[model samples]
Target: MSYVGRFAPSPSGPLHFGSLVAALGSYFQAKSQHGKWLVRMEDLDPPREMPGASDLILATLEAYHLHWDDEVIYQSQRHHYYQDQIEQWIASKEAYYCQCTRRQIKQSGGFYLGTCRDAALTPEQPCSVRFKVPTAIDHFIDQKHGRIAIPKALADEDFIIKRRDGLYAYNLAVVLDDIEQGVTEVVRGADLIEPTGRQINLYHAMKQPEVSYLHLPLALDEHGNKLSKQNHAPALNNEEPIETLLSAMTFLGFDIDAHITSANLDEIIAWGCQNWSLQQLPNSLASTARF
Candidate 1:
């Protein structure tokens, strides 16, 4: 199959340094393989989304020359698709409704213990839908991280597909969109490592072939905290595109000595695609950064 990858970001805030690194990393990886790269705005949670964050993210990507190949897809507009799949899961008993609160799940020792799997729950108001994950365990080979085994205990735990707020959850929306778009690979951050298992399970449940994954090393601050919008991480300076791109390159452990000073925007990106290597990346839980 010809490679197809994506850089999906939630529009909760402006594009920050960590955002740039993930975007550029995915961009270079796809471009290097001469593959199509798509962008998706994860705007499902209106309560957490900023009004102008999606537009600003696109502008920031353009400023960095990290162009997406197709028109960006927004999650909020695809509610019906998600709803259809949720209905299928519920009707088939592959998923069930839960009225358990966060406190209730916490009381079960952090991980949900299938308290409502057989409770004859209904999707009345204030109820969440959870997939009845099977006991069959499996593993996947990440393009960069090599082999990974999914823990059997976690795999058997019932996980949510739709929130009690009558809104689509991240796992469901992401899997549905990836299937719709034919995303061949997923390139993102280390923070999402655990979620990958649940996503793979969803793929099996949906009977769609799983896509490959390459989780880029997470960028942490001087205090060993990951740079994130929730932490109020500063947005990137579009004024200095090349400098910011270089900083991202460095974070990915790429050597930019050859074009740091000799190339313009296109040349720099061209060089990045040609020389990108996952071998140079640090697989530690996190990598320190000052960018």
Candidate 2:
């Protein structure tokens, strides 16, 4: 299959340095291989979404010249797709209704133990849908990090695919969309490494082809915390797009020449695509001190 990668971001806030790093990394990873790069807005949760954030994110990507191929996907609009999958899983007995709350799970040894797996709870009753994780996927190859092992407990736990509040879970939407988009590889931050194994199981359950994984180093703040919207990391400066882009590129382990300062956005991005290599990236968390 032709290489296809994506950068999916939630619309809870503007794109920050950390998010920019993820976007740039995915963009170059796809472009370097002459592959298609697509963008998807993880706008599944309305309660947390900031008004106008989605448009702002698109503008930021455009300003940085990280133009994506094909029409951008929004998770909220794809609920029917997610719902259809959930129904199929429920019907096929691959997934079941779960009424266990976070407190219930927390009080009962943290990870969900499938308490409601055979409860026979109906849709009319308040309940979420949880996938009955099949045979555990203990490990998967990470293009950047090599073979990473997952704890068996995590791999075996039945996880939620739909929340009782009626919102489709992140894992559910992401897997379905990636499969729908025919994503050949997933190039995102290392922060998501924990969910990879479960997502792999989801692919197997859906009987869809799995994609390669390349997790980029997470960008950390001076305090050593991962820079993120929740942590109030400042948004990317659109006025100095080149400087910002260069900073992100260097963070991804690119060797930027002083002369490159005179280059335009397209030239800088072309240079990035030409020089992109996962081997050059730092295998640890990247500090945002350069920013």
Candidate 3:
């Protein structure tokens, strides 16, 4: 299969430095291998989305010269497809309706303990759909982190695919989207590593081909917290793309020249692609920075 990678960003806010790092890493990896890189808007959760964030995100990518190959996809527009799959899973016994509340799961040691597996609750009642996890250890090799095995306890817990509020869950939407888009590899930040196993299991359940994964190091703030929109991380400086791009490249462990006279954004990005090295990345989860 041809190499297909993607940068799917939720339109919760504008792109921050951390967002740029992930986008740049994904873009460089796709270009380095002469593969197609696509972008997708994860705008499923309307309550959490900010007005005009989707357009702003695309504009930011263009300003940074992070061009995607194909037309961008939006999750909010694909609800019927997700709902159809949910119906199929319910009919095929691959999933069950879950009515357990968050407090109930928390009381059961934080991880869901299949409390509603045998409930046989009808969809008429308020309920979420959960994939019935098979009892097997889920493991995958990260391109950067080496072999990783999800704990048996976590691998066996039935996870939600749809929420009670008539919304699809992230795990379900993301895996389905990747499969549909023919994504060959997932290159994103390490903050999403925890969900890899669950997503792998989804592939197994659906009998779809699983994609390779490469999680980049997460950028942190002065307070040691991961730089995020929720943390109020400042948006990227669109006026100074070169400086910001260079700083992002440095955070990814690239040895940038101290001074580049008249170097444009395209040239800097090309330099990054030519020098991209997965082995040079920091193995640590967090990097503290003032930028």
* CA shift of 285, model 3, Å: 2.2
Candidate 2 similarity to native, TM-score: 0.98
Segments of candidate 2 deviating more than 4 angstroms: 286-289
lDDT of 1 at 277: 83
lDDT string for model 3 (180-291, tens) is 9999999999899888999988898889988999999899988789999999999997778888888888889888875542588888888888989998788886787546
lDDT of 1 by residue, 1-291 (tens): 888889999999999888888898889889989999999999999999988999999999999888899889999999999989989988999999999899998888788888888987776558999999874445678888898777776767888899888889898899989999989999998888777888988998988899989988888888888999998888998888877778888888887786355689888888889888888777775788756
Scored by TM-score, the top model is 2
lDDT pick, better of 2 and 3? 2
> lDDT: which candidate is best?
2
lDDT of 2 by residue, 167-240 (tens): 99999999999999999999989889889998998999988888899988889888889998999999998778
| Per-prediction TM-score to the true structure, in the order listed | 0.96, 0.98, 0.97
Error of 2 at 176 (Å): 0.8
Clashing pairs in 1: none
RMSD of 2: 1.0
Worst window of 10 by summed lDDT in candidate 3: 254-263
lDDT of each: 0.87, 0.91, 0.90
